[model samples]
Target: MTKFNKIVPDDFNVPMYVNGEFFILRPLSPVYSNLDYDAVIASKEILGDIFSDNWPEGINSREDNLRYILEDYQDFQDRIGFSYIILDDEESICIGCVYIFPSLYEGSDVAIYYWFNVKFAGTYLTVKIENFIRSWVVEFWGIKKPAYPGRDIPWSEWLTRPRKKFTD
Candidate 1:
């Protein structure tokens, strides 16, 4: 089933940035059709491992890709209320990107979806991206919201691990 509603960006206009050494993320919309399509294709090429690595096969051609991006960004926009482009800061190239959307699991905070080009792996970009998203969470949802770290880790582990617990 489709994960999100398909709505235009005019309804929810809040914009935020996720900083990185090579790239920065700014809000995206259909108006930036050419740029957004280029970024999406570049992202698919760079972070294909995580982004399009497992995408259903046989989706060839630009038309197929455009349809996919339309649905993909639309779902993200509907779910997260925003989307952003992955831009290279130095040369101003579009390397790859990430997306934030409503959490699927109950009792969880917002969902943070990150996919960066392989060239960006093992860089300060990861930490900066994490910190940026953390700041966004704090600003939009408040620090009191509980975030599940995922996996089979126990609630005790999460509560006792580093950083303050949501509920004492």
Candidate 2:
């Protein structure tokens, strides 16, 4: 039998660099009021089907966004799950988000989900970021085989099928 260890949120060091760019992996907080809401709304059009059920609605105002951020922050603090705001090297821009939480799948303990601005969708940076995330979770956090539940689409089709070479 294999020994199972739980991942504690404090084990992670925030604002780590990956792929030659500085990026932060801290949980969402109210202090992130500087988020570019307009850009997030704009990306929805480009996100297409991926944005369907995963994205939150009713973020028409900063207050709404803050509320969601606060909730996510609390979740991280409680070690229930983590929702990180992916920031730029200067930590001045919010380019995207990465969520790590308990798996909804029947036999998995953890799962991951991520998204970036449309501008990064087809770039090598996206692939690097994704690979960095997987390696980080396994090596640093000890989640050897994290799950990616296909809530938005079928897992086999989304991950294994021949698709656009966005992330290699």
Candidate 3:
């Protein structure tokens, strides 16, 4: 991961938006922070458990979420990472989020994390959504050995390995 800030190749076309039968994936701006904030807070406990991290802890305010969403959007624009807000098929409700970022470990091309609202955790749509994401990363993005640290590799093992952060 030496200076591997760009997860995909320069010629690769990063998908900014994806529309599927079950859900829609798109970058969210600060203007839609309310929807993102609502889903984040409502699914805080579950999301923390899913990621095994303390994330939505201090993000109790919509303003705080707005800043985070702005950063997410900026990351996509910069082409360093990709984060998408998963909305319902109608594109009105924020259901969850999925992220694709350069892996900090040596063996993986990229690290991916996706979580859904607790209510949709085990639902059919969630399963389909996860499949779509995995296929998109592998088939569309051409990511080999995409690391799903929490799922495929346990978080403990992943953290124990040496890190390879992006260079300045």
Candidate 4:
């Protein structure tokens, strides 16, 4: 299968950071382990629903969360995927995360997923982030079609859909 990086232009330069009215997006790293871990545990339930999977369940310590962020950093550095930790405007708190990568399901050029802390569960900030991501992927990555698996497609239906394949 063709990889996402293969489709990206050699000169493509993704944004190092993105700023929004309510939040900021920065690449995931171990530096924010304490803040990230606390946020994850605080919003584990909302995250479970957003991802439609059990995760962070096994994350019992800051070390566990650090490992997770390390993987995200590795994937990003390797150009396999991109994961960013969402932080409030002041940049002190970790509110959520966003993942952008090749689509696992058919009919989309890319897949994007995001979630906020439970406190922002139903706030306008959720709408702001969702809108920002939808447009950001298209403009930044030149994605013609972006799939929001959990938000746009029900997880059950999304899981049963055909997996995307790319040929060289």
Clashing pairs in 1: none
Separate clash counts for every candidate: 0, 0, 0, 0
lDDT of 2 at 96: 75
TM-score of 1: 0.56
Best by TM-score: 3
Q: RMSDs, each prediction?
A: 8.1, 8.4, 2.1, 2.3
Candidate 4, residue 136: Cα displacement in angstroms equals 0.9
Tell me the spans in candidate 3 whose CA falls farther than 4 Å from its real position.
1-4
lDDT of 1 by residue, 26-135 (tens): 65544444554555555454444443235423245556555756765665545433456666675255544455554444554444555554555557876676566667
Candidate 4 overall Cα lDDT vs. reference?
Answer: 0.81
**Position 92, candidate 2: lDDT:** 78
Candidate 1 Cα errors over 4 Å, as ranges = 1-13, 16-22, 30-53, 56-59, 75-81, 140-168
Model 1, clash count?
0
In lDDT terms, which candidate is top?
Answer: 3
> Which is better, 1 or 3, measured by TM-score?
3
Off by over 4 Å in 2: 1-22, 51-54, 151-168
Candidate-wise lDDT, in order: 0.50, 0.63, 0.82, 0.81
Per-residue lDDT of model 3, residues 1-168, tens digit only: 244476666788776578888788887767568988888988998877667577888797988898888888887877878888899988888878899888888888889988887768889998898888889888888887899978778988988878776675
lDDT of 4 by residue, 72-134 (tens): 788787766788888999889887888887787788777788878787777888788878888
In model 3, where is the ten-residue run with the lowest total lDDT? 1-10
Q: Ranking by TM-score, best first?
A: 3, 4, 2, 1
RMSD of 1: 8.1
| Ranking of models by lDDT | 3, 4, 2, 1
